[model samples]
Target: MASRSFAEEDFSCPVCCDIFINPVLLSCSHSFCSSCIQRVWRNKTLKECPVCRTTSSNDHPPVNLALRNLCESFQQERKPKSGPGVCSVHNETIKLFCLDDQQPVCVVCRDSRKHTNHRFCPVDEAVADNKEILKASLERLQEELRRSVNREQKLCKTAGDIKVHAQDTETQIKDEFKELRQFLDDEEAARITALREEEEKRSQRMKEKIEETSKQISSLTITIRDIEEQMKTEDVSFLQNVKATLQRFVFVSVLLNSNHHS
Candidate 1:
């Protein structure tokens, strides 16, 4: 079997240019994160997708399982905290839950969601559950590391392995260092990519908030200007009417007094 090098951190959803999540491919063969497409469609109000420029709709194709597997491997290799934190089976929050058989369930377990009405405890009520799951995961990772170390030790067990009589030990050391360096390089690059994606998500959410705030500010400003203009117009009309009435009254009184004197 070919050892496929997953380019999980390399690919991005074309529309978002960020790490792929729930990726969906367009007819144009361009793929974008599903949420990214929905967001762009809602905001842009355009028929064509931002990336493919092909006519788009709210319809989402089934998520790519290959992409999902790649993501899982990437997370395993990188070991970052930002990996998907939701439960796979229960599809609920796995906070303070167990990892053993049929695990990471929610408080309202009622597992089988259809058949058995199994009772479950609140996540907080079972503190040990959380610790056990964490320990299991840590153990698994440590075991894998140990296995890799054993494999390298075997490779260094013989003189033929290094193919050098005098500097065989030094050659083995170089190989070991090279392997460690490669592992570190992969991990650091993946971590850098994960961090960048997380930052983009945070920045995107903040920008949406800023946009909404700006719209409200603009709306309030317009409303205030409109009210002020209406008040000014009414004031001008009221003063002109008062002046005209006073002039007419004065003229009539003067005429009446003059006629009386004559």
Candidate 2:
């Protein structure tokens, strides 16, 4: 059995939504009309796939020769036969367009009872006028596409900028925290050093005071022992030395008072 013929959609270009014309293939495996892709990329900075939105590395993609040949063959196969342009009712060549019916009719059909009050114009003239209207419509659509592409580009750029800003802000925060940490560490070290110095100074002063107090205690102990020894002496000898002993006792009392004050 013969295989079924390929559908029209197989030869269609995604960009033009029509039969491929001079199709070009991107590295991403998508194909579009060369003119259509060029027009899409004309006002853009980066080249991208229209359907998938994939970024393309190549500015000028290679021609899809196999696809282009298929498109050409499909167009040839769908072309209207020459005799089909004749009107079936009048069996005449269709040269006029019925404005009311909006269909092509032969010269005889233009005056038929069915089209008595219908407006008519030459097929060529009507085709030209309609072509102009279609051209205008196509231009409007293209303009709308350009605007949409511009908006997409702006949105993409904004997203990239936002990402960059977030990264920079994060880096800045980390740096600031690092500096703060360093400052805190330095302050802590400085306070600890000051405390240690103060401790050393106070410890030395305490040691000196203890040594002086110890020397005073030793002197008082010697004076006490001498007094006790003199108390054991005979009463007559003790009476004779009592004046000198009293003077010595008065001197020792003064020393004790001074040590107490210090």
Please tell me which predicted candidate would have the highest lDDT against the true structure. 2
lDDT of 1 by residue, 81-106 (tens): 32233434234445533323323354
Instruction: Please identify model 1 stretches exceeding 4 Å from their true place.
Output: 1-9, 43-45, 80-262
For all candidates, the clash counts are: 0, 0
Model 2 alpha-carbon drift over 4 Å, by segment: 1-84, 112-116, 179-262
The TM-scores of all predictions, comma-separated, are 0.27, 0.34
CA RMSD, predictions in order: 41.2, 50.8
> Residues 29-87, candidate 2, lDDT per residue (tens digit)?
99998998998999899899999989899999999998888777666545433244666
Candidate that would win on TM-score: 2
lDDT of each: 0.47, 0.65
